[model samples]
Target: MYRYDEFDRDFVSARVAQFRDQVERRLSGDISEDAFKPLRLMNGVYLQLHAYMLRVAIPYGTLSSKQMRMLAHIARKYDRGYGHFTTRQNIQYNWPKLGDIPDILEDLAGVEMHAIQTSGNCIRNVTADHFAGAAADEVADPRPYAEILRQWSSLHPEFSFLPRKFKIAVTAAENDRAAIQVHDIGLQLKKNDEGQIGFAVWIGGGQGRTPMIAKKIKDFLPEADLLSYVTAIMRVYNLHGRRDNKYKARIKILVHETGTEELAAQIEAEWAHLRDGELRLPDADVARITDYFAAPDLPARAEGWAELAAWKKADSGFASWVTQNVRPHRHPDYGMVTISLKPIGGIPGDASDAQMDAVADLAEQYSADEIRVTHEQNLVLPHVALADLEPLYRALQAEGLATANSGLVTDIIACPGLDYCALANARSIPVAQEISERFGDQARQEEIGDLKIKISGCINACGHHHVGHIGILGVEKKGAELYQITLGGSADENTSIGEIVGRGFEPEKVTDAIETIVSTYLSGRSGTDEAFIDYYRRVGAAPFKEALYGDKAEAA
Candidate 1:
C-alpha cells in the first residue's frame, strides 16, 4: 500500500537499467553463463529446470488493488496465464523469458514493486504477519518497521554477499501467524506493563538439515531502536557466520557454534555503538509510513443479504466456510477474508489470471482496494464489510476460489520441486496434488479437523515441511522419488520441529502412508475435535509409525 517516493522510484529505475545492460552483455557473449550467474541472481532471475523463473518481491506481503491487477496482466501477457504464490508471501512467474525480465522489472517498478532481494545469499524480503493492520489484537502494525528494514538492506554494500540467505519476520498478534520463530531474525511486538511499545527479539531460527527455533537475544527493544537493533544483529551475524559449507552457512549455525549467550553478548556490544544513531527511527518517519496503512472507514451497518444469514444457518457448507475463511478485524464492522488458492484438485499456490483478476476486482469493490499475501499461500481481502459477505462469497465461489479449507488437511503448503526447481530431488507439486485430491471431500476434511500438511523438495525446507503437523519431505533414493514423513511439528507461537516417523516410502505409497497416519490418529485420538498435533503430543509417533509400516515392522 506504500507508494514510491522520488528516491524510491529512481532507485528501482536505475537498478532496472543496470540489469538491462547486464542482460544485453550476456546475450552478446561478453559474459558467459558463469559470469552472468551472480548478476542475474541479484535481479531475482533463476535458470530453473525448464525455463527462467522470476520471483517478484511483495514487500511484507502488502499490495494495492492496482498492483494486484498489474501482476495479473504480467501473468497473462508475458508468460503463462498463472503465477505461483510462495511460502515467503512472494509471487513467482514460472516461465519468464530471460530477455523479458528487464521488461518485467520495468513493469514492476511502475507499480512500486521490485524483485531485488527475492533471491541470492543477501538479506531476502522481510516478511510480517499477513493480518498485521487488520488484526484486532495487534500491538502495532509491523509494516513500517519492515519497510525501514527493506530500505536499509536493499543493495547494502557490506552485507550484499553474506554467508547465506537471511530472513526476518515480524508479528504483533498474540498467536504468531507469521512463524517468526523459524526466521533468521524474528520480532514480536510487545507492550510492557508501562504501556510503551517495543519488540521481543529472537535470532538464529531456520529450517534445513538442521532445524532450530530462534533464541531470544533481547526480551525488550524500544520502538525507536528497532532499525538500529536489527542493524547490530545483522552486523554481528555477517561478521561471525560460517562460510565453509553452503549447507551450514546460516546464522543458526553460528548461534549453535558460538552459543546463544555469546552471540547475544556480541549483538549487545554492537548495539551500544549503533543505538540512538542515525539509523534510529524518528516519530515523523514512523508516522509517514503508518499513514499508508490507515484503517478503512466502513458503514455503520453494512446492508446484508438476509439470504446470507439464512444460508449460514441452513447450510452447514456455508457455515463451515464462514467459520474458517472469515477473520476478525480491528474495525467493528469490517472483517478480513482469506481466499483459498488451494481448491479441490488444484495446485496449492498456483492462481490463474482470471482468478487473480476476480480477486483483485473483489478487493477493489467489496474491500478497500487492499490485498495481502499470507505465508500460507493464500490471498486476503483485509477490509471486507461484514454485511457484504454473501455477495463476496458467491463471487469467489463462481471463480473456484472459495474453498473454505483454511488450516485444514487439504490446505497444503508446497514448493515447486522437480517440476520447476533444479535443486529438488523429487517432485513436490504432484505429491501435494495427490494429498489434496485424496482429501478433497469437504465433510471428510472438516471431520479430520485441524491439520497441516507441508511438502518440501529437499532438506533446504523451502516448503516449510519441518513445521507442518504432518510434514512430508520428498527425497531421491536410487533416482526414485520417495517421501519421508515427520509428525508433531508446528509453526505458530508453540513452534517445534517435527520428528521423522520411519523409512521413506516410494511415490505410489506416499498417499497411502499419509492416509494411514491420519487414520491412526482418528482412531487413537480422544475425539474428532482433537487435532493431529494433539494426538501426536498425547501418544507420540510410536502408534502412527506402526500404522504406516504396520505392527511387525520397525519404526525408523
Candidate 2:
C-alpha cells in the first residue's frame, strides 16, 4: 500500500478541519439543509432515511492491518457495530450522527484514510483489481497508476463539480475483475508488441436508467501520456456534458448523444493542447509510485499438496470452503483467500466490528499483512500461504466470516435500499436475504455453479445489478414492491448488460421466480462445466423467460 507523504498528510488534515467547521455550522443553524448539502457531500456525508451515512474511501480497495483496525474502531465507537462494504469497494457507516461526522473524519485521517471524493459529482474513488500484484496473469500492478490518478483528481479545480459523479477503474489482468467496461473512464494496462506499457482506454461505460458498455477511444496510449490523455477526456466532458438535466448529466449520456468518434476527436483536440504541458507524467515520478507497490518479500516453498490433501480428506467443511473461497496466486505456494461476507441468510457485505478486527489479525498472522476489498463485496487476504489454509479457515469460522460460497448462487451483492437510502423505491436487503436462504444448501449452491445475483432498490445501479448473471431490481409499482429480473448480464472481460425477462414479480414470488430461472438453466445447460453465464450466452434467455412467465408470455 502507498503510505501518505507529508503533502498527503497535510492535505487530509486541512480538509478534515474544514469539514469539521462546516458540520458545526450546519448543526448550529448557521447554514440550512440546502446550503450544507454540497459541503457535506464533498466530504462523503449523506442524510439517509433514518440517519446520516458516512462513506469512507478504501482507495483501490487496498488496506493495511492498521487501517483495518481503525475502521473496526470507528465502527465500534461512532455508529453501529458494523459497516457495509459497497460495490465501489468502499465502506459505509449507516447510523452516524450528524454531529459525530467530523470526529469520524478525523479518526479516518489518523489512519491515512478519509471520506473525500467518496460522494458528490466530483471524481470518486479510483478502483483497481483486488488481486492486482498477486494475480497470476497480471501484466503489471495497476495501483501505482490508480494512485497517480487519485492524487491528480483529489481536488482538481478544473474537474470538480462536474454534472454528475465520475468513476474510474483500472485493471492489468485479462479477466477484467475490476469491471472496467462499466466505468466513466476505464483503463486496461497492457504491453504492446515492443513490450512497452500503456493503456487501452474506454469511455462512456455506465449503468443507471440507461446502461452502456464503454466504447474504446484509444487503442494504445503511451505510458507518459496517461495523465494528459485522461485530462483531455475530462476536459471534453466538463465542457459539453449535460448540465440541464440531472438525469442525463453523466459523461455516458454525452457520449451517447454525441457519437464516440466525435467525442474521441474532441478529446484528441483537447489533448493536443495539454499533451506535453505540466500534466505529462514524468518517468521518475511513475517509478517512485510503482516502487511503493513492490511485492512483499515472500519465500519460495514447494506446494503443500500432500498436507492440503490430507486435511481436505479429514475435514469436508474445510475442503468445501477451500474449493470455493481460494483463488490461485502468482506464487504457487501461496493463494488468495476470499473471506465471504455472504453467509447463508445473512446480509451481503456487512462485516461487524469484531469481524473486521479478526480479519486484520488473520491478515497479519497468515497473509502478508495486506487486505483487499473486491467489487463483488468480499474481502481478500491476497497472499495467504497454502500451508496456512486450515488454521486460517478455523479463525475465520470463529469470527462468523467462514462462508464457503464465494462465487456461488448464495454469494449475492445487494445495496442498502429503503432500509437506509432515501432514494430507494423498495427494500433490497430482505430480497437478498430471502434468495440467499432459498439457495442456502451447500450442495444446491454447488449445483448452481458460478452465478452472480445482484439486487438494487432502484435504477441508480449502486448494487451493479445491471451486470449480474441474474440481476434483480426492486421497483415500486401500484403501491407494491415488485422485482424486475434481468438475465445474462456480466461485468467480466466480455461485459454485457442483462436483458429484462418480463413483467416484474411481486416480492413474495421473487424467490420462486429465481428458482424457476435456475431450474431452467440446469435443465438446458450442456454440462456442469458450462457456467451460468456461458450457458445463458449459448442458449439465450428464451427458456428462462418461458420458465418465469409461461409459453404465451414468452412468445409475446
Candidate 3:
C-alpha cells in the first residue's frame, strides 16, 4: 500500500484531464476511430466485439479495503454488475460505454489507481508475488522494487512504444508463485553468501504463439544496480528487437534469434556505462519505499489454534474450506486466505459488485483492511488471524466467494475468449464452466489433487494455458471451434511449457477429453502422493496422449 504523494496525485490528475479531452474529441467526431485508436489504447480502453472494455491496473495486486470499495462502486455504477479479474492481477469491465470511461478513470484516480500501462507495448503493470509480504519463506518483500520500477517506467520516453509489450515480474519467495519465468523480465530476490540482498535476473521468458522460459542473464544483480541492469537489457532489446512483425516482436523472440551469451555481453557492455550513474538506487530511497510495505502488527492469537481445531471438528464444510483455501503465513497465528472467485460452474474470475463490496467489508473487519489479487484470478486476505477464520469464512460464504477450490481442478483460469475478446477464436467461458461443473464435487477434486487447468481462446496465452497442468487452447478450424490440449505444463519454480497431446477436440468433446486425461493420471500415478504434474513429468505426455487419442496418438 504505497500512498501517492503530492506529485503522484498531480501527475495522475493531469493524465486524467488529457484523456478526458481525447475521449471528448472522439465522441464529438473531431477525431475518427482510426485517429483515436492509439489514444484509447494508451488509456486502457479497448473496443471489444460488443462494447468497450476498460482494464484498470492493480499494481503488484495490492488493494486497500477503501480501494476495493471503489472498484465495487465502479462496477455497480458504470458497466455491468461484475468485473473480470485477469491473469495479470488486473480487473476488466466488459460493457462500459465509451463516453463514461473518463469518469471511470477519474474515479480510479481518486483511489490512486489508473488504467495507464495496463495495455500497449510499454512496460505493463509491474507484478509481484501476491503473497509477497505475508509468505513464510520470502527473502524480502518484492513490492518495493516493483513500485520502484513502476515509478521509473511510467511514461518513460526511452522504453515506451517498444517493439512489443513488455512485462516484468518479481518474487522473493522460493516457491515462485509469481510465475516469474514466463515474464519478459523476471527478478528473484535472494541473499548472497555475504548476506547482501540481490536478484537473479531472467530475461526473454514469455508465452504466446512462441512460448519460451526466460534464461538467467545475470546470476546476481546488486539490489542497488536493479534499474541500471534492467535499463541495459531494455536498451539491447529496443535496439535489436524486431519491429517488422508483431508476431516476433517480443523480447523472447530476440533472445531466441540472438544467442543468450551475445545478448548478455551486450547488456553488460551497456551496464558498464550506466551502472554507477543516476539510475543507481540509493539506500535511503530503497529504505523509504520498503517502509511503505512493512508487515502489519499481529497481536498474539495463540488461543485461535485451539478454537480452530474445535471449529473444524464441528463443521466438515468449514474444515474442507480451511484445508483448501488457506496457506501458512509468516506469522504462526495467521494464514493467507485465498477467496476463490471460481465457484463451481461459475465464470472463473468474474466477481459481482456486491461480492466485491462484501470482500472489502470482510477485509476491513477480519483481515488487516488489505486485499490481494492473485494471478490465478483469486482474491487473498493475506493477514487474517486464525481466530477470525470462522467469521470470515461465513461472510465469504454468504457472498459466494468461499469456494474452497484454491488449486483444485475446479479453480480454473480462463480468459475472456470469444465471448468478449475480438481476437479470440472460440468461447473460453463456456469451456471453463463445463470443466468446472464436471469436477465440482469436493471429494472428486480432492481425489484429483492439486491441478491447474488454464484455457485461452487463442494463442495469445492470456489464460496462461501454456503453463497449465492441463491446458486447453481454442482454435478455429473449418468454421468450427476446436480445443487443443497440452499436458505437463507448469508455472512454478521448475517451469516448463506443456506439449500438445493430440489433435484438437470439438467443443462438445473437450470436457470428456479433460476427464479422460484426469482418469488416466489417477490410474497411472504411483500413489495419491504423486501430483498430476509430478506424474506427467515422470512419464511424459505419452500416456495422456494415448488416453486422449487412443492408437492414433502416434500420428497426432
Candidate 4:
C-alpha cells in the first residue's frame, strides 16, 4: 500500500501521454503493426489470437478496496465482463480494443497502478509473499524490500533491455508460498546469529523449456548491501547472457553454461567495487519504506473463538469453508481468508466484474479494507477478524466467491492457453474445467488431500505446470492436441521440477489420466497422512508410470 508521491504521479502522467500519442499514431496508420509491436509490448499490450490483451501490474499483489473497485470498473467499461488473474499476481483483460488502451492506462494511473514492466525483457513486477505482513512465521515483511526494488528498477537504463525478461521474488516465511526458487532472482529474508535481518540470495531459477531451481549465490547478504549485490548479478548477466538465441537468453541458461562457482566469483568481484557505493541502502531509508507497510491495528477479539466454535457446530457448510479457505494469521484473533477463483467446473482465475466488486465491498466491511492477490490465482483478505468470518463467508457465497477449495484438486491453476494466447498449442481452460468438475465433490477432494494441478498451453510455463504435484502440459502433435503429465513437482521450500510420466494423452483422455494418477496415489500411499507429493517422492515415478501406461511403462 505504498502511496504514490508527486514524482510518481508526474512520471506516470507523462508516460500515459507518450503512450496515448503512440496509440493514436498506430490507429491512424502512421505506425505499422511491426513498428508498433515493441511500443505496445512495453506498455503491456499484446495482440493475441483473437484480440488485444492488456496486463495490469498489481505490484507485490497488494490492493486497496478502492483500487479493486477500479479494476471492476475497467472490466465493465473497457473489455469483457471478467478478467484473468495470472500466476505473477497480475490481471489480464483478454479482449480490449486497441484504441482504448491509453484510456485504460490513464484509469490505472489514477489509482497509482500501471502496466509498465508487466511484459518485455525487463525486470517485471517485483513480487513478494501475498501474506507478507500477516504471516505468523515471517521474520520481516518482504514487501518493503520489493517496493525498494520497484523504485530502483523502474525504467532503469542499464537493465531495461536485458537478453530476456527478468523476474524477482522475495519471501520472509519459511513456507515459501511465493515460489521464490523458480524466479530469476529469489530473496529469502532471514535473521542472522546476531539477530540482524538479511537475505539468502538465489539466482538462475526459472521454468520455461528449461526449468532449473535457483542456486544460492550468497549464504547471507546484509540488508544494506541488497541493491549493490543485485546490481552486480544483473551486470554479470547483462554482459554474458545469451543474446543470439531467444531460447537460451534467460539468466538460468547462463548459470547452466557457466559454473556456479565462477559466476558467484564474478558477482562477488563486481560487488567489491559497488558494495560501499551510492547503491548501499541507509537505515533511515529502510525505516521509511518499512513504515509504509506497518501492520494494521487489531483490537482484541477473544470472544470470537467461542463464537466461531458455536457457528461451526451449527453449520457444516460454513464449517467446511472455514476449514479450507481460512489460514492462521500472526494475530490469534485474526485469520487470512482465501477467496477461491477456481469454482468447480469454472474457468480458473477468471473473476467477473460483479464478483470483483463484491470482494471489494466485503474487504471494506469485514477485513481491513485491503485485498491480496495470491500467486495461486486467489484473492486473500489477510486481516479478517475471526468474529467477522460468518458474515464475510455469507457475502462471498452470495457472489459465488466462497468455494472452499484453497489447496485442493479443484483449486487448479491454468493459463489463457489456446483460447486467448497466440503462442499456445492447445486449449487450457477446458482441461482445467474438466478436471475441476471430475473432482468437484468436497468429500472426494478431502480424501485426496492437498494437491496442486497446474496446466500450461505450451512450454512457456505460464501456468507453472513444471511445479505442480500433478503437472499437465498441452502440446500439439500431428495437428492434434496432446496433454503431457508430469508428477511430483512442487513449488515449496523444497522445490523440485516435475518429471514427465509417459506419452502425452489426447484431450479427451487427459482427465481420465489424471483420475488414474490420483487413484494410484490413494491406493499406494501408506496412509491418508501421506500427501501426494510425499508419497510420490518416496516411491518415485515407477508406480504412477506403471498405472498410467500399464506394461508399456518402461518404454514410456
For 1-556, candidate 4 gives per-residue lDDT tens digits of 6999898999899999999999999999999999999998999999999999999999999999999989999999998899999999999999999989999999999999999999999999999899989999999999999999999999999999999999999999889999999999999999999999999999999998999999998989999999999999999999999999999999999999998999999999999999999999999999998999989988889988998999999988899899999999999999999999999999999999999999999988877889999999999999998999998888888999989999999999999999999999999999999999999999899999999999999999999999999999999999999999999899989999999998999999999999999999999999999999999999999999899999899999
Output the lDDT of residue 275, model 3: 97
Supply the TM-score for candidate 1.
0.98
- lDDT, residue 424, candidate 2: 94
lDDT rank, highest first?
Answer: 4, 3, 2, 1
Worst 10 residues of 4 by lDDT: 361-370
At residue 192, give the lDDT of candidate 2: 98
Q: What is the C-alpha RMSD of each candidate to the true structure, in Å?
A: 1.3, 1.0, 0.7, 0.6
Model 1: residues >4 Å from true position, as ranges? 302-308, 552-555
State every prediction's TM-score relative to the real structure.
0.98, 0.99, 0.99, 0.99
Q: After superposition, how far is residue 198 of candidate 3 from its true place, in Å?
A: 0.6
Model 3 TM-score is: 0.99
Candidate 4 segments whose C-alpha is farther than 4 A from its true place: none
TM-score of 4: 0.99
Tell me model 4's lDDT, rounded to 2 decimals. 0.95
